[model samples]
Target: MKWASDSITAGQITLLRVLFGFLPVLGYALARRALSRHHARHLHHYFAMSLLATSVFYYAFAAGTALLPSGIAGALSGAIPLFTFVCALAFLRSEPVTLLRFLGVLIGFGGVLLIARPWETTHGVDPTGVLFMLLGAASVGASFVYARKFISPLGIAPAALTTYQIGLALLTLMVVTDLDGMTTLADDTRALVGVVIGLGILGTGVAYILYYFIVETLGAVTASSATYIPPVVALAIGWLLVGEPLQLRDGIAVLLILSGVAVLRVTPRSGAAVSPTPRWGPR
Candidate 1:
Protein backbone atom coordinates (compact mmCIF):
# COMPACT_ATOMS: atom_id res chain seq x y z
CA MET A 1 0.00 0.00 0.00
CA LYS A 2 2.82 2.41 0.85
CA TRP A 3 4.30 1.76 -2.58
CA ALA A 4 1.03 2.76 -4.16
CA SER A 5 0.47 5.84 -2.03
CA ASP A 6 2.34 8.17 -4.34
CA SER A 7 0.23 7.31 -7.34
CA ILE A 8 -3.29 6.91 -5.92
CA THR A 9 -5.19 9.03 -3.45
CA ALA A 10 -5.78 7.37 -0.12
CA GLY A 11 -9.55 7.51 -0.57
CA GLN A 12 -9.33 6.03 -4.06
CA ILE A 13 -7.09 3.22 -2.91
CA THR A 14 -9.44 2.45 -0.02
CA LEU A 15 -12.37 2.53 -2.39
CA LEU A 16 -10.69 0.03 -4.65
CA ARG A 17 -9.69 -2.08 -1.67
CA VAL A 18 -13.28 -2.70 -0.62
CA LEU A 19 -14.52 -2.78 -4.18
CA PHE A 20 -12.31 -5.73 -4.95
CA GLY A 21 -12.50 -7.22 -1.47
CA PHE A 22 -16.27 -7.45 -1.52
CA LEU A 23 -16.30 -9.65 -4.61
CA PRO A 24 -15.01 -12.82 -3.02
CA VAL A 25 -16.93 -12.23 0.15
CA LEU A 26 -20.13 -11.74 -1.79
CA GLY A 27 -19.36 -14.89 -3.71
CA TYR A 28 -18.82 -16.90 -0.55
CA ALA A 29 -22.02 -15.59 0.94
CA LEU A 30 -23.99 -16.49 -2.16
CA ALA A 31 -22.51 -19.96 -2.36
CA ARG A 32 -23.37 -20.64 1.25
CA ARG A 33 -26.77 -18.95 0.95
CA ALA A 34 -25.78 -16.66 3.79
CA LEU A 35 -27.10 -13.60 2.04
CA SER A 36 -30.06 -13.20 4.38
CA ARG A 37 -30.88 -9.64 5.33
CA HIS A 38 -29.88 -8.36 8.74
CA HIS A 39 -32.56 -7.45 11.22
CA ALA A 40 -33.51 -3.82 11.53
CA ARG A 41 -32.13 -3.75 15.06
CA HIS A 42 -28.77 -5.08 13.94
CA LEU A 43 -28.57 -2.82 10.89
CA HIS A 44 -27.05 -0.04 12.94
CA HIS A 45 -24.42 -2.39 14.34
CA TYR A 46 -23.36 -3.41 10.86
CA PHE A 47 -23.12 0.21 9.80
CA ALA A 48 -21.02 1.07 12.84
CA MET A 49 -18.73 -1.89 12.17
CA SER A 50 -18.30 -0.96 8.50
CA LEU A 51 -17.56 2.67 9.30
CA LEU A 52 -15.02 1.92 11.98
CA ALA A 53 -13.25 -1.16 10.64
CA THR A 54 -13.43 -0.44 6.93
CA SER A 55 -14.08 3.18 6.03
CA VAL A 56 -12.26 5.16 8.70
CA PHE A 57 -9.50 2.61 9.23
CA TYR A 58 -8.54 2.17 5.56
CA TYR A 59 -8.47 5.89 4.76
CA ALA A 60 -6.69 6.94 7.94
CA PHE A 61 -4.04 4.24 7.71
CA ALA A 62 -3.47 5.01 4.02
CA ALA A 63 -3.13 8.71 4.72
CA GLY A 64 -0.75 8.08 7.59
CA THR A 65 1.39 5.65 5.62
CA ALA A 66 1.63 8.24 2.85
CA LEU A 67 2.95 10.86 5.26
CA LEU A 68 5.20 8.78 7.53
CA PRO A 69 7.73 6.02 7.10
CA SER A 70 5.93 2.68 6.87
CA GLY A 71 7.96 1.53 9.87
CA ILE A 72 6.73 4.39 12.02
CA ALA A 73 3.18 3.97 10.73
CA GLY A 74 3.24 0.29 11.59
CA ALA A 75 4.77 0.99 14.99
CA LEU A 76 2.02 3.46 15.76
CA SER A 77 -0.52 0.82 14.72
CA GLY A 78 0.93 -1.43 17.41
CA ALA A 79 -1.41 0.44 19.70
CA ILE A 80 -4.37 -1.42 18.18
CA PRO A 81 -4.11 -4.28 20.65
CA LEU A 82 -3.75 -1.93 23.59
CA PHE A 83 -6.71 0.10 22.46
CA THR A 84 -8.64 -3.15 21.96
CA PHE A 85 -7.84 -4.31 25.46
CA VAL A 86 -8.96 -0.99 26.87
CA CYS A 87 -12.14 -0.98 24.82
CA ALA A 88 -12.93 -4.54 25.83
CA LEU A 89 -12.53 -3.76 29.49
CA ALA A 90 -14.87 -0.83 29.12
CA PHE A 91 -17.49 -2.41 26.86
CA LEU A 92 -17.25 -6.14 27.45
CA ARG A 93 -18.73 -6.92 30.82
CA SER A 94 -17.15 -10.38 30.77
CA GLU A 95 -13.69 -9.12 29.92
CA PRO A 96 -11.43 -9.86 32.86
CA VAL A 97 -8.55 -7.59 33.77
CA THR A 98 -5.57 -9.09 35.56
CA LEU A 99 -2.53 -7.26 36.93
CA LEU A 100 -0.39 -8.66 34.16
CA ARG A 101 -2.84 -7.38 31.56
CA PHE A 102 -2.72 -3.92 33.10
CA LEU A 103 1.05 -4.06 33.17
CA GLY A 104 1.04 -5.15 29.54
CA VAL A 105 -0.96 -2.07 28.66
CA LEU A 106 1.60 0.09 30.41
CA ILE A 107 4.49 -1.62 28.65
CA GLY A 108 2.80 -1.14 25.30
CA PHE A 109 2.29 2.58 25.91
CA GLY A 110 5.93 2.87 26.95
CA GLY A 111 6.84 1.59 23.50
CA VAL A 112 4.48 4.09 21.94
CA LEU A 113 6.28 6.87 23.80
CA LEU A 114 9.57 5.67 22.46
CA ILE A 115 8.18 5.51 18.95
CA ALA A 116 6.69 8.98 19.26
CA ARG A 117 9.86 10.49 20.80
CA PRO A 118 7.95 13.65 21.52
CA TRP A 119 11.00 15.26 23.06
CA GLU A 120 12.81 15.26 19.70
CA THR A 121 10.31 17.53 18.00
CA THR A 122 12.97 19.13 15.83
CA HIS A 123 13.13 16.02 13.69
CA GLY A 124 10.56 13.99 15.50
CA VAL A 125 7.55 12.22 14.01
CA ASP A 126 4.86 14.17 12.22
CA PRO A 127 1.98 14.85 14.62
CA THR A 128 -0.63 14.79 11.88
CA GLY A 129 0.60 11.47 10.62
CA VAL A 130 0.76 10.04 14.12
CA LEU A 131 -2.76 11.25 14.80
CA PHE A 132 -3.99 9.64 11.60
CA MET A 133 -2.38 6.31 12.47
CA LEU A 134 -3.70 6.36 16.03
CA LEU A 135 -7.15 7.26 14.81
CA GLY A 136 -7.09 4.34 12.43
CA ALA A 137 -5.85 1.97 15.13
CA ALA A 138 -8.36 3.15 17.70
CA SER A 139 -11.18 2.96 15.20
CA VAL A 140 -10.44 -0.68 14.39
CA GLY A 141 -9.71 -1.42 18.01
CA ALA A 142 -13.13 -0.16 18.97
CA SER A 143 -14.61 -2.07 16.06
CA PHE A 144 -13.27 -5.32 17.48
CA VAL A 145 -14.95 -4.68 20.78
CA TYR A 146 -18.08 -3.50 19.04
CA ALA A 147 -18.26 -6.63 16.93
CA ARG A 148 -17.71 -8.91 19.86
CA LYS A 149 -20.29 -7.12 21.88
CA PHE A 150 -23.02 -6.49 19.32
CA ILE A 151 -22.32 -8.57 16.23
CA SER A 152 -20.73 -11.76 17.53
CA PRO A 153 -23.36 -12.39 20.19
CA LEU A 154 -25.89 -12.44 17.39
CA GLY A 155 -23.83 -15.10 15.65
CA ILE A 156 -23.72 -13.66 12.15
CA ALA A 157 -21.65 -15.85 9.82
CA PRO A 158 -18.16 -14.48 9.23
CA ALA A 159 -18.71 -14.47 5.49
CA ALA A 160 -21.96 -12.56 5.85
CA LEU A 161 -20.41 -10.08 8.25
CA THR A 162 -17.44 -9.55 5.99
CA THR A 163 -19.66 -9.09 2.96
CA TYR A 164 -21.82 -6.53 4.71
CA GLN A 165 -18.88 -4.57 6.10
CA ILE A 166 -16.92 -4.44 2.84
CA GLY A 167 -20.04 -3.97 0.76
CA LEU A 168 -21.15 -0.97 2.82
CA ALA A 169 -17.66 0.46 2.79
CA LEU A 170 -17.52 0.18 -0.97
CA LEU A 171 -20.83 1.95 -1.34
CA THR A 172 -19.85 4.67 1.11
CA LEU A 173 -16.56 5.28 -0.68
CA MET A 174 -18.28 5.38 -4.05
CA VAL A 175 -20.45 8.23 -2.81
CA VAL A 176 -17.72 10.35 -1.25
CA THR A 177 -14.50 9.41 -3.07
CA ASP A 178 -13.29 11.73 -5.83
CA LEU A 179 -12.51 9.81 -9.01
CA ASP A 180 -10.28 12.56 -10.49
CA GLY A 181 -6.91 10.77 -10.43
CA MET A 182 -8.13 7.21 -10.08
CA THR A 183 -7.06 6.41 -13.61
CA THR A 184 -3.45 7.20 -12.73
CA LEU A 185 -3.24 4.03 -10.69
CA ALA A 186 -3.16 2.01 -13.92
CA ASP A 187 -0.16 4.03 -15.07
CA ASP A 188 2.11 2.44 -12.45
CA THR A 189 2.09 -1.31 -12.80
CA ARG A 190 3.63 -1.92 -9.41
CA ALA A 191 1.19 0.40 -7.65
CA LEU A 192 -1.68 -1.06 -9.64
CA VAL A 193 -0.77 -4.61 -8.67
CA GLY A 194 -0.11 -3.63 -5.07
CA VAL A 195 -3.44 -1.89 -4.72
CA VAL A 196 -5.42 -4.64 -6.43
CA ILE A 197 -3.78 -7.84 -5.25
CA GLY A 198 -1.87 -6.80 -2.14
CA LEU A 199 -4.25 -4.38 -0.48
CA GLY A 200 -7.52 -5.34 -2.11
CA ILE A 201 -7.81 -9.08 -2.64
CA LEU A 202 -5.59 -10.43 0.11
CA GLY A 203 -5.29 -7.68 2.70
CA THR A 204 -8.88 -6.53 2.81
CA GLY A 205 -10.75 -9.50 1.38
CA VAL A 206 -9.27 -12.72 2.74
CA ALA A 207 -7.87 -10.93 5.77
CA TYR A 208 -11.21 -9.72 7.13
CA ILE A 209 -12.79 -13.14 6.74
CA LEU A 210 -10.07 -14.61 8.92
CA TYR A 211 -10.31 -11.65 11.29
CA TYR A 212 -14.06 -12.00 11.77
CA PHE A 213 -13.68 -15.71 12.31
CA ILE A 214 -11.18 -15.00 15.03
CA VAL A 215 -13.48 -12.40 16.49
CA GLU A 216 -16.21 -15.00 16.71
CA THR A 217 -14.02 -17.84 17.96
CA LEU A 218 -11.57 -16.21 20.36
CA GLY A 219 -13.34 -12.99 21.29
CA ALA A 220 -12.35 -9.42 20.55
CA VAL A 221 -9.25 -8.75 22.64
CA THR A 222 -7.58 -12.01 21.76
CA ALA A 223 -8.57 -11.63 18.12
CA SER A 224 -6.85 -8.26 18.08
CA SER A 225 -3.56 -9.84 19.19
CA ALA A 226 -3.03 -10.70 15.52
CA THR A 227 -1.91 -7.12 15.05
CA TYR A 228 1.18 -7.61 17.21
CA ILE A 229 3.10 -9.32 14.41
CA PRO A 230 2.92 -6.49 11.87
CA PRO A 231 5.33 -3.99 13.43
CA VAL A 232 8.39 -6.14 12.85
CA VAL A 233 7.33 -6.86 9.28
CA ALA A 234 6.67 -3.17 8.67
CA LEU A 235 10.04 -2.14 10.10
CA ALA A 236 11.85 -4.72 8.01
CA ILE A 237 9.99 -3.71 4.84
CA GLY A 238 10.61 -0.03 5.47
CA TRP A 239 14.35 -0.59 5.87
CA LEU A 240 14.88 -3.14 3.10
CA LEU A 241 12.37 -1.97 0.49
CA VAL A 242 11.99 1.73 1.12
CA GLY A 243 15.49 2.41 2.47
CA GLU A 244 14.03 4.05 5.57
CA PRO A 245 16.65 4.45 8.29
CA LEU A 246 16.06 2.80 11.61
CA GLN A 247 17.56 3.61 14.97
CA LEU A 248 18.23 1.56 18.08
CA ARG A 249 15.22 3.14 19.72
CA ASP A 250 12.97 1.88 16.96
CA GLY A 251 14.04 -1.67 17.63
CA ILE A 252 13.65 -1.27 21.38
CA ALA A 253 10.22 0.25 20.97
CA VAL A 254 9.04 -2.62 18.79
CA LEU A 255 10.52 -5.08 21.30
CA LEU A 256 8.62 -3.50 24.17
CA ILE A 257 5.40 -3.49 22.18
CA LEU A 258 5.71 -7.16 21.22
CA SER A 259 6.71 -7.96 24.77
CA GLY A 260 3.53 -6.35 25.94
CA VAL A 261 1.55 -8.57 23.58
CA ALA A 262 3.37 -11.59 24.91
CA VAL A 263 2.60 -10.63 28.47
CA LEU A 264 -1.05 -10.12 27.65
CA ARG A 265 -1.16 -13.43 25.88
CA VAL A 266 0.23 -15.27 28.89
CA THR A 267 -2.13 -13.63 31.30
CA PRO A 268 -4.68 -16.32 32.15
CA ARG A 269 -7.49 -13.85 32.54
CA SER A 270 -6.92 -12.59 29.03
CA GLY A 271 -7.14 -16.03 27.45
CA ALA A 272 -9.48 -16.90 24.60
CA ALA A 273 -11.23 -19.36 26.88
CA VAL A 274 -12.77 -16.35 28.57
CA SER A 275 -14.52 -15.36 25.37
CA PRO A 276 -17.97 -16.83 24.97
CA THR A 277 -18.55 -18.98 21.91
CA PRO A 278 -20.68 -17.49 19.16
CA ARG A 279 -24.36 -18.37 19.27
CA TRP A 280 -26.53 -18.61 16.17
CA GLY A 281 -28.42 -15.40 15.47
CA PRO A 282 -32.18 -15.10 14.90
CA ARG A 283 -33.60 -16.09 11.53
Candidate 2:
Protein backbone atom coordinates (compact mmCIF):
# COMPACT_ATOMS: atom_id res chain seq x y z
CA MET A 1 0.00 0.00 0.00
CA LYS A 2 2.78 2.46 0.82
CA TRP A 3 4.39 1.69 -2.52
CA ALA A 4 1.23 2.30 -4.55
CA SER A 5 -0.24 5.17 -2.53
CA ASP A 6 1.93 7.71 -4.34
CA SER A 7 0.48 6.67 -7.69
CA ILE A 8 -3.24 6.24 -6.96
CA THR A 9 -6.01 7.14 -4.60
CA ALA A 10 -6.51 4.95 -1.53
CA GLY A 11 -9.94 4.04 -2.83
CA GLN A 12 -8.48 2.70 -6.02
CA ILE A 13 -5.83 0.71 -4.16
CA THR A 14 -8.47 -0.76 -1.90
CA LEU A 15 -10.72 -1.60 -4.85
CA LEU A 16 -7.93 -3.36 -6.70
CA ARG A 17 -6.88 -5.17 -3.56
CA VAL A 18 -10.31 -6.72 -3.14
CA LEU A 19 -10.69 -7.34 -6.87
CA PHE A 20 -7.39 -9.09 -7.33
CA GLY A 21 -7.47 -10.92 -4.01
CA PHE A 22 -10.95 -12.20 -4.75
CA LEU A 23 -9.90 -13.81 -8.03
CA PRO A 24 -7.66 -16.54 -6.60
CA VAL A 25 -9.93 -17.13 -3.63
CA LEU A 26 -12.89 -17.33 -5.97
CA GLY A 27 -11.07 -19.88 -8.10
CA TYR A 28 -10.29 -22.00 -5.05
CA ALA A 29 -13.91 -21.80 -3.97
CA LEU A 30 -15.06 -22.97 -7.39
CA ALA A 31 -12.62 -25.86 -7.33
CA ARG A 32 -13.79 -26.94 -3.89
CA ARG A 33 -17.45 -26.19 -4.73
CA ALA A 34 -17.59 -24.05 -1.58
CA LEU A 35 -19.89 -21.38 -2.98
CA SER A 36 -22.63 -23.85 -3.90
CA ARG A 37 -22.79 -24.94 -0.27
CA HIS A 38 -23.04 -21.41 1.19
CA HIS A 39 -26.18 -20.60 3.19
CA ALA A 40 -28.05 -17.80 1.50
CA ARG A 41 -29.66 -16.72 4.77
CA HIS A 42 -26.24 -15.88 6.20
CA LEU A 43 -25.31 -13.53 3.40
CA HIS A 44 -25.94 -10.52 5.62
CA HIS A 45 -23.36 -11.72 8.13
CA TYR A 46 -20.83 -12.10 5.37
CA PHE A 47 -21.56 -8.61 4.09
CA ALA A 48 -21.15 -7.10 7.54
CA MET A 49 -17.87 -8.92 8.09
CA SER A 50 -16.55 -7.82 4.69
CA LEU A 51 -17.53 -4.23 5.32
CA LEU A 52 -15.49 -4.10 8.49
CA ALA A 53 -12.64 -6.47 7.59
CA THR A 54 -11.83 -5.67 3.98
CA SER A 55 -13.49 -2.40 2.91
CA VAL A 56 -12.91 -0.19 5.94
CA PHE A 57 -9.73 -2.00 6.93
CA TYR A 58 -8.03 -1.64 3.56
CA TYR A 59 -9.11 1.98 2.98
CA ALA A 60 -7.84 3.15 6.34
CA PHE A 61 -4.63 1.19 5.83
CA ALA A 62 -4.04 2.72 2.39
CA ALA A 63 -4.69 6.24 3.61
CA GLY A 64 -2.53 5.84 6.70
CA THR A 65 0.33 4.07 4.97
CA ALA A 66 0.47 6.98 2.52
CA LEU A 67 1.29 9.47 5.27
CA LEU A 68 3.10 7.58 8.00
CA PRO A 69 6.38 5.74 7.78
CA SER A 70 5.65 2.10 7.03
CA GLY A 71 7.16 0.90 10.31
CA ILE A 72 5.08 3.23 12.42
CA ALA A 73 1.94 2.37 10.49
CA GLY A 74 2.54 -1.32 11.08
CA ALA A 75 3.37 -0.87 14.75
CA LEU A 76 0.13 1.01 15.21
CA SER A 77 -1.65 -1.92 13.63
CA GLY A 78 -0.11 -4.19 16.27
CA ALA A 79 -2.79 -2.86 18.57
CA ILE A 80 -5.38 -5.04 16.88
CA PRO A 81 -5.11 -7.69 19.58
CA LEU A 82 -5.79 -5.08 22.23
CA PHE A 83 -8.91 -3.88 20.47
CA THR A 84 -9.93 -7.48 19.81
CA PHE A 85 -9.71 -8.36 23.48
CA VAL A 86 -11.70 -5.26 24.42
CA CYS A 87 -14.38 -6.01 21.85
CA ALA A 88 -14.53 -9.63 22.94
CA LEU A 89 -14.95 -8.62 26.55
CA ALA A 90 -17.86 -6.40 25.62
CA PHE A 91 -19.63 -8.58 23.09
CA LEU A 92 -18.58 -12.16 23.68
CA ARG A 93 -20.15 -13.51 26.82
CA SER A 94 -18.09 -16.65 26.69
CA GLU A 95 -14.81 -14.76 26.27
CA PRO A 96 -12.82 -14.74 29.49
CA VAL A 97 -11.51 -11.35 30.56
CA THR A 98 -8.76 -11.89 33.08
CA LEU A 99 -6.58 -9.37 34.88
CA LEU A 100 -3.63 -10.51 32.80
CA ARG A 101 -5.46 -9.63 29.58
CA PHE A 102 -6.42 -6.22 30.96
CA LEU A 103 -2.79 -5.56 31.84
CA GLY A 104 -1.81 -6.66 28.37
CA VAL A 105 -4.18 -4.13 26.82
CA LEU A 106 -2.67 -1.37 28.91
CA ILE A 107 0.87 -2.39 27.99
CA GLY A 108 -0.07 -2.48 24.33
CA PHE A 109 -1.46 1.09 24.46
CA GLY A 110 1.72 2.23 26.15
CA GLY A 111 3.56 1.13 23.03
CA VAL A 112 1.06 2.88 20.83
CA LEU A 113 1.63 6.15 22.72
CA LEU A 114 5.35 5.75 22.24
CA ILE A 115 4.74 5.49 18.51
CA ALA A 116 2.20 8.34 18.34
CA ARG A 117 4.24 10.68 20.60
CA PRO A 118 1.32 13.09 20.86
CA TRP A 119 3.38 15.11 23.32
CA GLU A 120 5.72 16.20 20.57
CA THR A 121 4.00 18.75 18.38
CA THR A 122 6.65 18.49 15.69
CA HIS A 123 8.31 15.38 14.16
CA GLY A 124 5.77 13.17 15.85
CA VAL A 125 3.81 10.60 13.92
CA ASP A 126 1.15 12.25 11.79
CA PRO A 127 -2.05 12.47 13.81
CA THR A 128 -4.27 12.00 10.80
CA GLY A 129 -2.40 8.90 9.71
CA VAL A 130 -2.34 7.52 13.24
CA LEU A 131 -6.08 7.99 13.48
CA PHE A 132 -6.68 6.21 10.19
CA MET A 133 -4.46 3.28 11.14
CA LEU A 134 -6.13 3.03 14.52
CA LEU A 135 -9.50 3.03 12.83
CA GLY A 136 -8.34 0.24 10.60
CA ALA A 137 -6.96 -1.75 13.54
CA ALA A 138 -10.18 -1.26 15.45
CA SER A 139 -12.27 -2.34 12.48
CA VAL A 140 -10.24 -5.49 11.99
CA GLY A 141 -10.19 -6.13 15.73
CA ALA A 142 -13.96 -5.86 15.95
CA SER A 143 -14.32 -8.09 12.93
CA PHE A 144 -12.41 -10.81 14.77
CA VAL A 145 -14.83 -10.78 17.66
CA TYR A 146 -17.76 -10.47 15.32
CA ALA A 147 -16.61 -13.46 13.33
CA ARG A 148 -16.24 -15.53 16.45
CA LYS A 149 -19.68 -14.52 17.66
CA PHE A 150 -21.57 -14.77 14.38
CA ILE A 151 -19.75 -16.32 11.43
CA SER A 152 -18.16 -19.23 13.27
CA PRO A 153 -21.55 -20.49 14.38
CA LEU A 154 -22.59 -21.11 10.77
CA GLY A 155 -20.24 -24.09 10.38
CA ILE A 156 -19.02 -22.80 7.01
CA ALA A 157 -15.71 -24.04 5.70
CA PRO A 158 -12.82 -21.59 6.03
CA ALA A 159 -12.42 -21.23 2.26
CA ALA A 160 -16.13 -20.57 1.80
CA LEU A 161 -16.17 -18.08 4.67
CA THR A 162 -13.24 -16.19 3.15
CA THR A 163 -14.89 -16.29 -0.29
CA TYR A 164 -18.12 -14.77 1.04
CA GLN A 165 -16.25 -12.04 2.89
CA ILE A 166 -13.84 -11.11 0.10
CA GLY A 167 -16.49 -11.45 -2.63
CA LEU A 168 -18.82 -9.01 -0.89
CA ALA A 169 -15.93 -6.65 -0.18
CA LEU A 170 -15.10 -6.63 -3.89
CA LEU A 171 -18.68 -5.76 -4.80
CA THR A 172 -18.77 -3.01 -2.18
CA LEU A 173 -15.54 -1.49 -3.44
CA MET A 174 -16.80 -1.60 -7.02
CA VAL A 175 -19.78 0.57 -6.07
CA VAL A 176 -17.82 3.26 -4.21
CA THR A 177 -14.44 3.31 -6.00
CA ASP A 178 -13.68 5.59 -8.95
CA LEU A 179 -11.84 4.15 -11.91
CA ASP A 180 -10.41 7.50 -13.08
CA GLY A 181 -6.61 7.79 -12.68
CA MET A 182 -6.46 4.23 -11.41
CA THR A 183 -4.72 3.17 -14.59
CA THR A 184 -1.84 5.51 -13.74
CA LEU A 185 -0.49 2.70 -11.60
CA ALA A 186 0.56 0.88 -14.78
CA ASP A 187 3.50 3.27 -15.13
CA ASP A 188 5.06 2.35 -11.75
CA THR A 189 6.42 -1.18 -11.93
CA ARG A 190 7.27 -1.48 -8.23
CA ALA A 191 3.93 -0.13 -7.14
CA LEU A 192 2.03 -2.29 -9.59
CA VAL A 193 3.85 -5.46 -8.56
CA GLY A 194 3.55 -4.56 -4.89
CA VAL A 195 -0.16 -3.99 -5.14
CA VAL A 196 -0.95 -7.02 -7.26
CA ILE A 197 1.38 -9.64 -5.80
CA GLY A 198 2.24 -8.39 -2.33
CA LEU A 199 -0.96 -6.80 -1.16
CA GLY A 200 -3.60 -8.55 -3.23
CA ILE A 201 -2.68 -12.19 -3.63
CA LEU A 202 -0.37 -12.89 -0.71
CA GLY A 203 -1.45 -10.29 1.84
CA THR A 204 -5.20 -10.33 1.40
CA GLY A 205 -6.12 -13.58 -0.32
CA VAL A 206 -3.73 -16.11 1.18
CA ALA A 207 -3.56 -14.31 4.53
CA TYR A 208 -7.33 -14.33 5.12
CA ILE A 209 -7.70 -18.01 4.27
CA LEU A 210 -5.19 -18.87 6.98
CA TYR A 211 -6.65 -16.25 9.31
CA TYR A 212 -10.21 -17.59 9.25
CA PHE A 213 -8.84 -21.08 9.74
CA ILE A 214 -6.93 -19.90 12.80
CA VAL A 215 -10.00 -18.09 14.07
CA GLU A 216 -12.05 -21.27 13.76
CA THR A 217 -9.47 -23.34 15.60
CA LEU A 218 -7.95 -21.01 18.16
CA GLY A 219 -10.68 -18.40 18.71
CA ALA A 220 -10.85 -14.68 17.89
CA VAL A 221 -8.46 -13.02 20.31
CA THR A 222 -5.87 -15.74 19.84
CA ALA A 223 -6.14 -15.51 16.07
CA SER A 224 -5.72 -11.74 16.29
CA SER A 225 -2.45 -12.16 18.18
CA ALA A 226 -0.93 -12.93 14.80
CA THR A 227 -0.94 -9.19 14.15
CA TYR A 228 1.89 -8.59 16.58
CA ILE A 229 4.42 -10.21 14.27
CA PRO A 230 3.82 -7.64 11.53
CA PRO A 231 5.22 -4.68 13.43
CA VAL A 232 8.74 -6.07 13.67
CA VAL A 233 8.54 -7.40 10.13
CA ALA A 234 7.39 -4.03 8.84
CA LEU A 235 10.12 -2.19 10.68
CA ALA A 236 12.75 -4.50 9.23
CA ILE A 237 11.31 -4.19 5.74
CA GLY A 238 11.02 -0.42 6.01
CA TRP A 239 14.65 -0.10 6.99
CA LEU A 240 16.12 -2.67 4.61
CA LEU A 241 13.90 -2.43 1.53
CA VAL A 242 12.47 1.11 1.66
CA GLY A 243 15.52 2.70 3.33
CA GLU A 244 13.39 4.23 6.06
CA PRO A 245 15.30 5.09 9.22
CA LEU A 246 14.34 3.30 12.39
CA GLN A 247 14.36 5.05 15.73
CA LEU A 248 15.05 3.80 19.24
CA ARG A 249 11.39 4.36 20.07
CA ASP A 250 10.39 2.06 17.25
CA GLY A 251 12.30 -0.86 18.68
CA ILE A 252 11.08 -0.15 22.20
CA ALA A 253 7.51 0.20 20.99
CA VAL A 254 7.68 -3.07 19.10
CA LEU A 255 9.02 -4.82 22.17
CA LEU A 256 6.26 -3.49 24.41
CA ILE A 257 3.54 -4.27 21.93
CA LEU A 258 4.78 -7.79 21.30
CA SER A 259 5.20 -8.40 25.02
CA GLY A 260 1.62 -7.30 25.54
CA VAL A 261 0.36 -9.69 22.88
CA ALA A 262 2.42 -12.45 24.45
CA VAL A 263 0.82 -11.73 27.78
CA LEU A 264 -2.62 -11.86 26.24
CA ARG A 265 -1.93 -15.25 24.75
CA VAL A 266 -0.88 -16.81 28.04
CA THR A 267 -3.95 -18.29 29.65
CA PRO A 268 -4.53 -17.46 33.30
CA ARG A 269 -3.80 -20.27 35.77
CA SER A 270 -6.74 -19.25 37.98
CA GLY A 271 -9.12 -21.59 36.16
CA ALA A 272 -10.39 -18.82 33.86
CA ALA A 273 -10.85 -19.76 30.22
CA VAL A 274 -8.40 -18.24 27.77
CA SER A 275 -10.62 -17.83 24.72
CA PRO A 276 -13.52 -19.69 23.21
CA THR A 277 -12.33 -21.87 20.37
CA PRO A 278 -15.38 -22.73 18.29
CA ARG A 279 -15.32 -25.66 15.89
CA TRP A 280 -17.07 -24.41 12.79
CA GLY A 281 -15.83 -27.22 10.54
CA PRO A 282 -13.66 -30.30 10.60
CA ARG A 283 -10.20 -29.50 11.95
Instruction: Please report the candidate that would top lDDT against the real structure.
Output: 2
What is the alpha-carbon lDDT of model 1 when measured against the actual structure? Answer: 0.83
For model 2, which pairs clash? none
lDDT of 2 by residue, 125-144 (tens): 79999999999999999999
Find the 10 residues in a row with the least total lDDT in model 1.
Answer: 274-283
lDDT against the true structure, each candidate: 0.83, 0.87
- Model 2 TM-score, all chains together: 0.95
* Candidate 2 wrongly placed segments (more than 4 Å): 270-283
Regions more than 4 Å wrong, model 1: 38-41, 268-283
Residue pairs in collision within model 1: none
